[model samples]
Target chain A: MDDLHSPDPTEQSWGSLLRTNREEVLEKWTQTAAANLGGRMTPAEMGRDVDEIYSALVRADTGDQIDIRSAAYADLRSLLTELSRTRARQGFSPTETAVGVYALKDAVLEILEAHGDLPGYRAFARLSRIVDDLGMFMLETYATTREAVIAEQAEALLELSTPVVKLWDGIVALPLVGTLDSARTQVVMEALLQTLVDTGSEHAIIDITGVPAVDTQVAQHLLKTVQAARLLGAECIISGIRPQIAQTVVALGIEFGDIHTKASLADAILLAMRRSGLDVVKSR
Target chain B: MDRIPILRIGDVLLVSIQIDLQDQTALALQDDLSSKIVETGAKGVLIDISALEIVDSFIGRMISTTAAVSRVLDAETVVVGMQPAVAITLVELGLTLDGVRTALDVDRGLALLSSALGKAGSDVEVDDLAHE
Candidate 1:
């Protein structure tokens, strides 16, 4: 423990040591990082990213205590954040992105081995801690960026899933695929209602053929949507309820009330057309 | 209290609510509507609430009561021009307004009212013939 706090005779700091051997450390760091990244980035691009990070790190060293959360390391942390965010968006794994920072430890270790001095070993210990901190920081930023990407994809999927197709002059059909959650139901309701007002359609058909199952909550959402459409003076017909779903609905004792339901989308569309005062006859 | 105007369009009474209705104003409108229906002997009532952005339970109850009062006076009530947001709000608030009929807009409301009254007129005629 006493050896841990032993003062350097020459009073050398990691920052100055890094500066003296900056060219060697940076080249080795970039090379190791490039190899770790599996040639995903060009040599010039990787060199530029590492050069920016190296400059910020050199400036970030205030004293022996390298607290990454300090004001001095703020710039370095921001640079890491930007680098990790881009890597995350580029479909790089968390370990892969973080390994890029950890590569610096190996680069510094090689330099420390060449020096083979007692104070150089102590400085390397502190340097390795800072590298570990930066690696963890990159991991956190990567996680958050991946989370943001996932959230954006979910919103886009919600938009793409609910489409209100115009079946006839005064009829619209909403073909719902996948499971029905409250958030999805709200989107479907708003879109269907807006379309109704836009087209002035008197009849709407909600087809759930792509929907896998129907539970009590799903049934409740359907009822609310139908009631909302009815309040807008548009009749709603629920279609594409499979035989299994029908059994599940009845077994659960969920009352659909007066909302018209059909077995298939075609049947629902036919009902909507007939209600809109149109009849389809086979052409002889 | 501000009174909601009741316009006579042939046999259907059109009440276009263009203001944010307070409780007292809603009550006054209900009173005025009932009196107008009786005076004109209208066969149907169309309430256009498109301009109303905010509708609380008080206004919702007033609309239902107005429909009930119109029904008692031998007139069908068709509420029209309810905005999508307002309709969603009403449903979320559990005010389905089951007994009252609804239409997309004033024109559709008029058509629905006319057709409904036409059916009622023919049924009354059949009853008169039976009585004879």
Candidate 2:
């Protein structure tokens, strides 16, 4: 009979098991850790921490418990917070911090899973805050980026001498100042259209006098605006066609025959008055 | 993919089109928008396409159709934020938009509509004068 005290090579200590079967132990630990951290960490943080913990668990051996109770986890939390603040101060994109938070959460979860115990609720709470902060940071950064892009794009497209102003009669004048490209054309179209509806104006003067030139594309867009105005029974009078623009129009051989174009903004206002047949001229 | 949010400012309903207005989404949006316009009894509908990068033929047709339908419902339709490239592309593609009001933005579109409505009211006086 074998001696009762005989040691079996297969029944090794935790440390030896980790060393000899690192891959298998790590895999098992990762799954356990993720499960343990489930609902305790944000998705992003969990993802990050999972990788870290997996590495830590692979290094752990028999007689070694996954010690998330140590000050290391708290230090990690503080480090992440500092990193977030530092990144914010540096104006580095929040995405970077979000990525870091996710990694930390993942590592914590993995450690817990390998140990088959849960982190303290306080630790979980800290993780949650990190995730939330990162989410907000990312969202705000995205919104700012989006607004900046929109403003830049709109400025480029609209090319108006006066982008914004208020009128006493509530009739705002948006004098387009440069070439109308497809993107900017859309911005102008939308701005004018929305202005009409919002202000309930009887007339809108799109003075293109400052526009360098006109092509068939520009002409068509102008026509579309006119047609759109008529749909709402609103009249959009195109004004400010510099000689160069007129020459370009004629050169392109595009017909403004069906559309209304005025040599000047004054002409456009007069045309609008005539079209509306409003005799606003006061009698002395 | 689901319900599109339509914002109402005064008598005008501002519908911001951020997602791709294509196929089922277009049809769904049209149906939903038409019903909302009728229900809200809005005077005008402004389609804000500042977020859209592309406007296909189907979408263009839908816009025109929506405007026409809105008119029948006594609500005017205005399309705003049509990028110049989109305008050029649409024209080159031979897509015709009839009965759809357009402006540079929502504010201008509202002003134009108000002025047009005001003119319509005054036109009644003109008609009365002509009859006299």
Candidate 3:
């Protein structure tokens, strides 16, 4: 009974069985995934992703063992990873991205059910195992892709937050607006110091009004920044010290050591101007 | 055995250290600077370290000591043009060089020195008036 159309299920590998029904399986898989995604992706894009994965799966010679991590499935695994990365970048949920691979199981099962025999049922089970491994792989890829996206955004946020603004001639100001961790403080310190040299500004104001809390560690960071600026021969004035922050600084026994602290940015600018020998007088 | 040259501009003694200072060289420079400050009767001392890229803790201490010696001689000391990396390294080493003033460059250093001299002159005048 070695017929091309009706080969014995036990004698045929799942790869060959899959190849024989590739068109039907791909169409069914794409349709199910499209419904699951609520049509967020166009049909052409969905079809292309499904087509790539199906071709790679049919080419993989799983034989008896169904390890997706095996060398036999390397091509298939990479194809699935690529699909998941695209889905993740498009903002698809984990379940939605993984379901694209899982849908192949139902499509294969439908084809096996049409045969209606015990051997056909056994073949479906083996294929089902391979599909399960692939779905998990897709899920793992999705997680890593999302994590990469988050890390890139966090770095961008750090850059956007710390801006060394030139307030006036011989005066620059850094408006701090977040938690002062060691990493952020290091970035802030370097940027301020570089600006001090580039602009030849003798006075700098660090406005901490947006800083929500002041622990000993944060106070230490501020002191380090001011000291670094002083090394460049630029004086730094810490401004926007709300009453609460002042109390916290005193309570924590953090000695700013003669570094000027002002109540507001405006006051800090006024002091910086006075030190630079400039006075603002209103003209009538 | 090379000695760092000490240049005098107006009332400011300019010590531009261009070489990586050895311990003996630093000691010799310190001696020469102090004697020159006395001989010239300079009002301010400007140390341009922009050419120096590397400094150990010994050199850091030498700078502070030089400033102290200048201060005792009735001259203000200003360290100018310290590189950012050098500044960070010094801070990390915990050498803050307390009591030594800093400027961005020799131009700024001269300005700082003159302004300081101006203030000191006015303070002397006030003291004279108080004595009267």
Candidate 4:
């Protein structure tokens, strides 16, 4: 909306006149922010943040600067980004942050109305559009940053959940305890294969005793894990074949091929020990 | 013409494939191994493929053929020292190399051969005892 070479006289004068009532607009903006902020922040901190953006806008000679994407609003864009990220980290909602920007329209309009020598209708339209654009930028940045934070947290949680343990000499156990998905399956396979190499174990017992249910995808993931173990010359024995799971497996007609499956972890471990040439004799 | 050398170690012919195998080299190794097993009358063949990072279908088929040919000649073939990445890739390639037996390393492969030999020795002892 602004022309750098041919400055609109009315637009230039509006910006010049705006500086005269800067203190009054700053006061009203902080009051509206304090009222809307609702105890989340002290009035002093809220006032300080609003003061910085207000001076930048007035100095940018934001008369007729309606288009936020234009070079004229570059400083405003960066300022809003910093504000949105800080508020996102502070656990403030997007609407709350956007409303802080939106509340500016009322404060500025009131200040201009009291000055009787207001700009023409065209200049007023440009000022209103600028505030609207700033509000939209704040909401957009808040949403995008919040989603990124959630995704990072999920990845960290996945790493924590998958754990590989060496159960005995020449034997390792991967006790799975949640719903299996492709992403988690990749982690499980890599962990199991690495431990198999580290321990040089001949047999690995994958106990899914804590697994909630099974489906075609889960079965496929399990098969991939078993196949990978076998490639390393380590035999895989699936444990926790509960009757319900057995029924589901049979109903699905899923053939496990030559991969071993046992009814319980104890049975699987015993089989693994036997294959590793351990004879567990009962003490009489 | 990178011919993978086949060495006769006692009753087992040890072949370590330590090259980026071309199709001809793999086929030549298969032919050389089969003839060596027959000429030495070796009871077992140990193939150390730890250096074979990629096992494409042609190389895979050559190994399977060698195993089949040796089995017909009363010899057992065990491929050993396969890397974990190669194994995972081979499985993904849908070539499990099912017809052949495998071991983690040369030591385990030797142990596997000796244990079977030991079992054969006991069978002979039992036969002599039965005759007596």
Maximum-lDDT candidate: 1
Q: DockQ of every model listed? A: 0.39, 0.04, 0.40, 0.25
- Which candidate has the top score in DockQ? 3
> What fraction of native interface contacts is shared by candidate 4?
0.24
Ranking by DockQ: 3, 1, 4, 2
Return the clash pairs for model 4, or none.
none
Share of real contacts kept by model 1? 0.62
Stretches off by above 4 angstroms in model 4 are A1-18, A62-72, A110-121, A278-284, B117-132
Question: Candidate 2 — which residues are off by over 4 angstroms?
Answer: A1-258, A261-284, B114-119, B122-132
Against the hidden true structure, what lDDT does model 1 obtain?
A: 0.85
User: How do the residues B1-132 of candidate 1 rate in per-residue lDDT, one tens digit apiece?
Assistant: 688889998898999999999999998888898999899999889999989889888788788888889999988999998888888888988898888889899988887777677655643542343223
Model 3 alpha-carbon drift over 4 Å, by segment: A1-11, A20-24, A42-48, A62-75, A109-129, A278-284, B20-24, B35-43, B72-74, B118-132
Choose 2 or 4, whichever is better by TM-score: 4
Question: How would you encode candidate 3's per-residue C-alpha lDDT over A1-284 as one tens digit per residue?
Answer: 13242355346566666777778888888888788888788777888888988888777765676787889788988888888898899898999899888888888888777764565566567788989888988999999999999999989988988999998998999999989899899888988998999998988999999999999999989988888789889888899999998999899999997788889999888788766652121110
Kindly list the per-residue Cα lDDT of model 4 for residues A115-175, writing each as its tens digit: 5443433445566777888898899999988998999997987798778888889899998
Instruction: Note the residue pairs that clash in candidate 3.
Output: none
RMSD of each: 5.7, 17.4, 5.2, 5.7
Question: What tens digits encode model 2's per-residue C-alpha lDDT throughout A1-284?
Answer: 12122165223233332344345544543444345444444555444454453344333321323343344344434444454554455454555435543443444445445653222333334444544654454445545555666787767655543363333243445687777776776666667656665565656777887777788888877777655544443555567888887887888898865456778877666565554443342110
lDDT of 3 at A232: 84
TM-scores of chain A across the candidates, in order, are: 0.86, 0.42, 0.83, 0.83
Candidate 2 lDDT, B8-68, residue by residue in tens: 8878888888876667887888888889887888888888775766877887777778778
DockQ of 1: 0.39
Full ranking by lDDT? 1, 3, 4, 2
By summed lDDT, the worst window of 10 consecutive residues in model 2 chain B runs over B123-132
